[model samples]
Target: MKLKELAHSRTGDKGNISNVSLIVYHLEDYERLRQAVTAERVKNHFKDIVKGEVIRYELPKMGAMNFVMQEALGGGVTRSLSLDRHGKSLSSYLLEMEISLES
Candidate 1:
């Protein structure tokens, strides 16, 4: 299954960093999301765009997680020439990642 099936995402950016949040639709799915969506995996998933570290914050109480990706915006929004300078579409890209939901 795709990550999108389990959660929706939001994104924010500052300088060259993009912060993405994954909020699960239900609390019961949070643990599965945590186990499968590792920082390493996410870094690789956005390897072409993100050039720095991917740090993940666990927010179990909120059934959500936040990922901070550095060196992601081609320098910064105001300076970047990329079509999506603010990286608004990055959350959609992240949600495209495939995950296994095995019992």
Candidate 2:
């Protein structure tokens, strides 16, 4: 199943950094997402777009994970030439991550 099936995301950018918040729809899904959505996994998932480090912060009470991606906005919103200057596409891109339903 795709990550989208279990979660939704929101993104924001500051300079060259991008922050993505992934929130699980149900409490039961939180553990599964916690196991699958590691900082390394997210970095690998956006390897081509994100040129720097990926840091993840877990919010167990909210059943959410926030990913901080450095050097990810092409350069920065003001300096970037990319169409999605704010990096909105990133959240959608992250949602494409595939995971095993049985896991």
Candidate 3:
């Protein structure tokens, strides 16, 4: 299944970094999301756009995960020439990631 089926996402950007949060709708899905959505996988998923490291902060209590992607904004919003300088669309891209839901 795609991550979108299990979760929704939000994105924020400062300088060249973009922080994307994946929030699950159900508490029961949290553990499964944690197991499948590793930092390495997220980094690989956005490798073309993200030039630096990807750091993930677990928020089990909120049934969510925050991914901090460095060098992802092309540059800071003011300086970047990219169409989506704030990287708002990045969250949508991340949600397109595929994951297996283990029974």
Ranking by TM-score: 1, 3, 2
Clashing pairs in 3: none
Model 1 lDDT tens row, 1-103: 9999989999999999999999999999999899999999999999999999999999999999999999999999889989999999999999999999785
Candidate 2 local lDDT, residue 86 = 93
Report how far residue 49 has shifted in candidate 3, in Å. Answer: 0.5
Give the TM-scores of the predictions, in the order they appear: 0.97, 0.96, 0.97
Candidate 3 has its poorest 10 consecutive residues by lDDT at: 94-103
- The most accurate candidate by TM-score is 1
- Candidate 1 has a TM-score of 0.97
lDDT of 3 by residue, 25-82 (tens): 9989999999999999999999999999999999999999999999999888998989
lDDT of 2 at 79: 92
Error of 3 at 87 (Å): 0.2
- Deviating ranges (above 4 Å) for candidate 3: none
lDDT of 2 by residue, 1-71 (tens): 89999999999999999999999999889998999889999999999899999999999999999999999
Which of the two, 1 or 2, has more lDDT? Answer: 1
Please report, in order, the local distance difference test score of every candidate based on alpha carbons: 0.96, 0.94, 0.96
How many Å off is the CA of 6 in candidate 2? 0.5
